[model samples]
Target: MALPAASVQLYSLAKEFTADPQGSLDRLAAIGLKNVEAFDFVRRPAEIRSALDASGLVSPTGHAPLLTDELWTPDGSIPTPAPEVVFEAAAAIGIQTVIDPFVAPERWLTEEGVADIAERLNSAAEKAATFGLNVGYHNHAQEFVASFGDHTAYERFVSLTDERVQLELDLFWALTGGQDVPALVSRLGDRLTAVHVKDGIVPASNPWAPGAEAFGSDSLDQRHAGTGEVPLAAALRAGSAIQYAVIEYDRAPGDVFADIEASLGFLREGGFVA
Candidate 1:
């Protein structure tokens, strides 16, 4: 099969997007992107749909909260809407997968907490299926904080959840969690449906902490793709089942659009995305 289309997480340019969602997308289109991983689209499906139609880009996947009471971000949080409402909005906007971008760090600390996270998502997945939408989870480094036997909380959650609950691994965060990133991708197999392709120089004293620092830099230095310490090529080589290689950054290293273009070049030239 052809590799999945390259995508850019809109959150990588969250500020510019919030200011001009249409303009931000226009820039992406100019960069040759055909897909995007949307954030904060639950409350404005019609508006987003219109914008997407105008831009000629499709958002097959998007981020919204299904487990939490509120969706948190560095900018702010949006109150979590009912799953039925979320599904309705997603359907209206032509989203195929509704991946919960985050759950609190503490939720991954204990076996019981991880179990609840899985159970709740499994229930959500069942509900989402009714709308012809798939549910998934995106990881931050925090999920690796606590270990349950040989596996971490993330792995345990993987075991507890139904197979339909897809995964979108953030490669940079996985590295921050001190994981052998490529090996983890191979191990995840078909369950891994997407990856947030990122690069950065990780700090020396990294630890498996129970919070969002593992998601991105607390003190690490961000870099353009292929220039950072992350073995992005190796990780992508292992993602045999990955559907969307989303270019992202918690804090952009330079001219955001130019930075994204560089990563896109890396993915395309390296044949990581079709």
Candidate 2:
């Protein structure tokens, strides 16, 4: 199979990017990246598009909230925008697939909740098509916290969502949830269009599990790709139709740009991306 293209989630350098969008993107371009996965871009699509264009980079996929009333992060919650609004913004930024980055942990714990999440994303996908865009979902460890009989909530979610909805799995989070990362990638098969190339020491416990204390990105022990515990190479190899291997860090281990470069180096040296 052909290798996927290397991309970075702009969230990896959110602070720097927020401070200097164009300069940050230019630095990524200097590192030889041709593609990026935008984050929190719905509010300023035109500015981001201009920056990406100036940097000679393209954002084929981006993150936005679609299935939730309000988007939650470890830090705070952002009010969710309407799907039509999201699609319009994504199209403006040249994003082909708008992926919802998170759904609350409690929402992934039951049959009905998982079904609702899938149904909402499926509907969003239909609406997004009108704007010449597609919609997808990204998972955190929360998706694996509950199972209905033999299937994980994540598995059931995949089965419920339409084919048009894509999946972007975070390998480190999957491992944190006690999954065999490469095996899950194989099962996801062609639908897995992207993988978050994040590597880190697995947290001692599932932080999203019920009763766990609140935590933020600063608490993560993330490392450059292949330097941590995640089976990134095996997971990348297992993907049958992966198109973008996106490097991300909830928290960078060092200078953010250098950290991103190190992960990009891993992808290049390991022959995981084109």
TM, every model:
0.94, 0.99
As for model 1, its CA RMSD to the true structure in angstroms is 2.1
Model 1 lDDT tens row, 100-205 = 9888877888899999999999999999999999999998777887899999889999999999999999888888777899999999999999999989887564
Residue pairs in clash, model 1: 141-214
The residue ranges of model 2 lying beyond 4 angstroms of the native Cα positions read none
Tell me the alpha-carbon RMSD of every candidate.
2.1, 0.7
Most accurate candidate by lDDT: 2
Best TM-score among the predictions, by candidate number: 2
- Span of 10 residues, lowest total lDDT, candidate 2: 68-77
